[model samples]
Target: MDLVQLDIKGISYSQTQTGAYALLLSEIGGSRQLPIVIGAFEAQSIAIALEKDIKPPRPLTHDLFKTFSDSFDITIQKVIIHKLVDGIFYASLICKKGKNEKTIDARTSDAIALALRFKAPIFTYKNILDKAGIQLKTSTSSSQTQSPKSKVETEIKSSFDLKSLSLKDLNKLLEDAVQNEEYEKATQIRDEISKRS
Candidate 1:
């Protein structure tokens, strides 16, 4: 089966799943998007990799892996979402060291995060894409109407009585959220700090 290249479209907080995030990957030349639900840590790691401006005070696990791989002269050539079973996606890292190439199994979310850090392309089989891809509606009329209400709800949830916390307390909460891999909470705390400044 032929492989189709995918690009990271965006990541959004999953409204249906508490503490889960949705990672959207779009076909390079197509409108279909595959949405995979990921954990908060993976979401944060991927987001940090994608956003050049945001840097963690300490290296994340994915960053450490990149550092270690670089030290050993290993390069990630690409990542492939190879399988989907029972609603879970499986991925592999195609790594090169000197003249040797090896494929290593990885979770789909971790593979995508590492792929971004490595500047490697992401691919998936055509069959999988056909099975899971969603065609985006061309019309934006309905979405525009619904967006404001959702945005308001999101703001209310993220605000979370941030006014009562000191700057120092907010910073502490941010650190704790990051350490605990509560990325959504960390984002809220970070936003609160940014607003204060």
Candidate 2:
């Protein structure tokens, strides 16, 4: 089967599942989006990778993996979302070490995070996209529209008492949340910092 390239659209908290996040991947040059549910930690890792400005004080697990791979001269060529079984997506990393190439099995979430760090392309089979892709409704007005997930994220952003915390406290909390693998919380803190600056 032919493969279709995908781009990371965004990540949002899953309304149907507590502590899970919806990772949206849009087909390149297409309106259809594939939503994969991932754990909170993975969601945070992916978000951090996407945000070029927000850097954790310490290296995240994904960051560490990238550094280790670079040290060993391993380059991630691409990531393929190969299988979907019982609502779970399976992915593999296409890595190259000089003339040698290897495929490594990885969870879809982890594969995507590493792919971003490696600047590798992401792809999925057309069959899989047809099975799981959602078409977004185009709006006719000039006013910007938001997804339900985006609305929820906005609500979360406004609910936090970020004004009460000092910049030093917020940074400390951000670091602690990342260290504790509380990505959602870390995101809110990061947003607060972004707003302040």
Candidate 3:
């Protein structure tokens, strides 16, 4: 099976699942997208990397893994979103250690968290995309719309819009949201902070 390359076009909070986030993968030169729900911490890690924020005092877990990989002279060649079983996505990391290449099975969230930190390409089997991806059906079917991509983009954009609130206000809102266990709101606030930086 051919591995169809995908890029992390965006990440957004999952409206249907509390404390979970939707990571959007856009097919290279194609109009299809795969949405995988991930945990909040993983989502924050990916968002921080994507936003290129370095203001944090302590490195996140993904950053620690990247540091470890660099220290060992290992390179992450790519990540493959290999399968979807019972509504869960599976992934693996392709790594190069010296002259040998190895694949390690990983949870999709951790794989993507590491992939974003390593700046590696992500791929998926064509059949997996066909099975898990919901194609956008447009009238006449001449040009299909990428509905998932647009939805994810819109959610992220809204979450990161600085004009939506003052920093002090957002911080206060974040504190209250976190206290209430409103992780979705907290993730949005975290995204807002990373976006601001």
Candidate 4:
């Protein structure tokens, strides 16, 4: 599968879920964004990495891993959000030591945190992005229908857990999204609805 580069846009505190934050990964040169819900601890670690001036009193777990890798001459080449299952994202860290390279399995959150610390780039399969990412604007796509957004683009929080909602509720959301001209959101709800039936 083709790989799409990603950059951390920001971390958002989930309005509907306690102690849960959304890690927003924006496609490097596109309007699509993938939001993955993460825990508070992982969120804190990623936030700290993004803010260069804010150093912790001591090295956090991710920081310790960075230190250990440096001592062993290991290089974190990049991070890849390799898979998504049941709304959970799976990732891998591409690491290199001397002439040897290895891909280590990791949680999507931790992989992103490490990527930031190492200044490594993040990537995901194009298909995964298509399945999970929300388009932030209308753009020419690869033979796919493009949703038009008005000039005043408001950020829309995606329906994170469609499986949790009853089919009736899912139908309601789909109707609302279509009425609101939220084609991207509607597309997601439609997919979930299709999965059930």
Top candidate by TM-score: 4
Where is model 3 poorest over a 10-residue stretch in terms of lDDT?
A: 148-157
lDDT of 1 by residue, 6-37 (tens): 99977888654688997878899997767777
Q: Residue-pair clashes per candidate, as listed?
A: 0, 0, 0, 0
Question: After superposition, which runs of candidate 1 have C-alpha atoms over 4 Å from their true positions?
Answer: 140-197
Residue pairs of candidate 3 with colliding backbone atoms: none
Displacement of residue 108 (Cα, Å) in model 1 is: 0.4
Candidate 4 error regions (>4 Å):
138-197
Kindly list the per-residue Cα lDDT of model 2 for residues 1-197, writing each as its tens digit.
98999999788775545898868788999987677778999999999999999999999999999999999999999999999776678999999999999999999999999999999999999988876655454446888654354433344446657677778777666555444444456545655665675
Clashing pairs in 2: none
For model 4, residues 77-184, the per-residue Cα lDDT tens digits are: 999999987667899999999999999999999999999999999999999888776655443567875457422222234435677777777666666554454444
lDDT of each: 0.80, 0.80, 0.73, 0.80
TM per candidate: 0.71, 0.70, 0.69, 0.75
Output the lDDT of residue 114, model 3. Answer: 90
Residue 32, candidate 3: C-alpha displacement in angstroms = 0.5
